[model samples]
Target: MVRGKTQMRRIENATSRQVTFSKRRNGLLKKAFELSVLCDAQVALIVFSPRGKLYKFASSSMQETIQRYRNHRKDVHNTLREQHLQQLKQEAIELMKKIELLEASKRKLLGEDLGSCTCEELQQIQQQLEQSLKRIRERKIQVFKEQIDQLKEKEKSLAAENEMLCEIREKIGQQARQESNEDREMVALTESSENSDVETELFIGPPEGRIKRTLTSLYI
Candidate 1:
């Protein structure tokens, strides 16, 4: 092939294009075979024709040659990937150092450990720390307000339960009092002589010597 002599244009004639494809394909396959034999190297070449037919050549079995090529490419990619990972690791270390410096500066600003800083530096640090603290305090207040709301809700629920229990206790107490009064009345009626002494003018009886409710009260 002539070096840099061809114009950058397609061969429009179908027959010329087909002829060129065949000749170039043969030359490429010849070059691959020569490289394999002369350099004691494995080689593989694959070409797809315009009609979608495959054309191929290899110094040995196509599978073995292709496998060798793939392995060679994989080794190169692995080396590059390792180099990239090492670069990333170095960058990560740098980032960590920066973070440590920033944290130390922040601690100094907060008036935490000022043994190493000058008075002026401490003042600047304090100013920055005050701003940060103000932000944090605002956030804390917001959280506290939310908690207070939650507590209020819980108090409302508990109050409702307490009111219900109080009502139930009052009803039970009233029922017990009514039962006790009934029991007392029955006991006095059974005595037969006591009611006449206490309320003789207001009381009446069915007959003398008649008693009522001698048995204990039944739930039914």
Candidate 2:
């Protein structure tokens, strides 16, 4: 019968866990010692028990070995940091070169620094200028059309306002003419009333005066 592999898990029993720790600690210490003796290599091992007990084995001074490890890690980290810095410097140089080329191209487009341009380069610049001018003219035409539309809208608004004002003026004139006719009719009625208000007094005057006036009229 084949023996089954034991599962590599924590032992739950306290006695079994202590026994396993003791066996493993002795085996590990023996291995470290043999390796150091046979190969003449520095070795360091540290183990902590569940009860906070310390166990250690070292071929050389433990503090010296740990310091050496720390120094080696620091040196490796510094080397990596220097390599990253150099890569960033190279990328910055490349970016600066690109920026300079763009600036030179911009200057050339603005009719500056033309002493080194080839015939083909000049032709390319001319084509770029022509394309730019074409776009600018198109934009100008679009702006002019927008302005004209705006002006037409403003003119329509003014015309509508003028028509409204003319209607108001005509109404005002008609009202004034009606008022004038009413005033003239009132004045005529008042004058006719004054003419009909004559006082006729028929008095019994002296008969001699009447007779004398009658005789004077007959003689005439």
Candidate 3:
């Protein structure tokens, strides 16, 4: 029968744990030695027991392996650091370019640096300003027309009022002339009636003095 796989766990008993540590340590060292001899490869191993006992195996001098490992780690660290620095430098250059573009845009918005603008850009700005001027002129003309219309209306109203006043004055003058003519006619009629009302007497005869003398002589 095939054996079932072993489940690994920490040993609960101190004695069992120590025994297992010794066996595993020896086995690991043997495997390191065999790998070096058979494969002609450099190998190193280190182990520390629970009690702080040290064990190690090396195909070469232990100090040499440690020094090589340290050197390799240092080389890797320097390579990574150089790569990071180069990446940062590239990003900084891109950021500076972006900043320069932003500053140029700001200058253009503020109406500065027009000398450096291309023909197309200048044309665009010119068209915009011209459109604004046209709008302003149209608005001014509209306002002037409105004012002129109002003035014309006022002039017409004043003319009508003047005509009405002139007609009223002429009517009053005609009525006064008619009243004066009637008064003069009445005064002439009264004076003719007064002349006609005076009294008068009339008689017809010869000389009375000669007739009286002849009659008196005869009688004497």
For every model shown, the clashing-pair count is 0, 0, 0
On residues 64-158, what C-alpha lDDT tens digit does candidate 2 reach at each position?
A: 99999999999999999999999999999999999999999999999999999999999999999999999999999999999999999999999
lDDT digits (tens) for residues 67-138 of candidate 1 = 877898999999999999999999999999999999998787656778988889877877887898999999
Task: Write the candidate numbers in order of decreasing TM-score.
Answer: 2, 3, 1
lDDT of 2 at 174: 100
TM-score of each: 0.49, 0.56, 0.50
Q: What TM-score would candidate 1 get against the native?
A: 0.49
Candidate 3 lDDT, 91-190, residue by residue in tens: 9999999999989877775689999899999888678778979999999999999999999999999999999999999999998888888888888787
Worst 10 residues of 2 by lDDT: 195-204
Quote the positional error of residue 182 for candidate 2 in Å. 25
State the lDDT at 30 in candidate 3. Answer: 99
Reference-based lDDT, residue 67, model 3: 93
